[model samples]
Target: MPASQYADMFCVEVWPENAPAWNLFEALQTQWRAGSGGVIGLDYGVLAEELRVREIPPADHEQLRADVRVMEAAALQEIYAETEK
Candidate 1:
């Protein structure tokens, strides 16, 4: 089943390798126990903040951002197609 079917709210965490981001997020959302998968969207604002916090070098950040944009565009296209259907 989709996560949205189980949980009313979602907390997406993007963090460094050392950080227990998922565990921490799950702890906060203890009311609704949901497993992760079938993500239809990317929170780019949160992504940017994570990249900044991780101190990703400007050059690498640009490259990563470009890659993420491509992914976000594809996800949007798929979502639009589903809606059109």
Candidate 2:
């Protein structure tokens, strides 16, 4: 896909332990959809529902989480550096 396809993309990671965070997520989703006239692309519900039916093998779960953590950290660091510039 072209890079522009993801220009407005946003990602969130929520573990079972942080289930309450979904309330905030839902609120953001509502606000974004409303402000953008429902043109913000795919909603989190799409991914959430996909995750509901998909099962990750126990062996790979930790590694997947760790990889996501690393990527998220890097992205945040990049953003911080950019802001400091």
Candidate 3:
């Protein structure tokens, strides 16, 4: 689930500091939820614009982006089924 995967797919982040944590992303077909193990959710495009207008720091915002990218890449690779091996 690299941000690149979700890059073309639709997605949205979740509440900060929650149990499900950064594990939730609303996409076109399904929700690629995050587990306790990885990634942070960051808003995108116009959504990010709103956050910026509200004075949210880009550093804080992109921090989540960087995380989502890492987690998503791992998740995508994880889609490899045992049968495929």
TM-score of each: 0.47, 0.40, 0.36
Give candidate 3 misplaced runs (Cα > 4 Å): 1-56
For residues 1-85, what per-residue lDDT tens digits would candidate 2 score against the true structure?
A: 6676675475656787544334333433332222333232324454344334455455644544444345445645665577679
TM-score, candidate 1, is: 0.47
Q: List, residue by residue over 11-84, the lDDT tens digit for candidate 1.
A: 45556752443332222222222236344455556666666776767676666766556645675687668867
Best by lDDT: 1
The sequence of per-residue lDDT tens digits that candidate 3 reaches over residues 59-83 is 6666655554565666566664432
User: Which residue pairs in candidate 2 have backbone atoms (N, alpha carbon, C) closer than 3 angstroms, thus clashing?
Assistant: none
TM-score of decoy 3: 0.36
Show the colliding residue pairs in model 3: 1-72, 1-76, 2-72, 2-73, 23-34
When 1 and 2 are scored with lDDT, the better candidate is 1
lDDT for residue 40 in candidate 1, whole number 0-100? 48
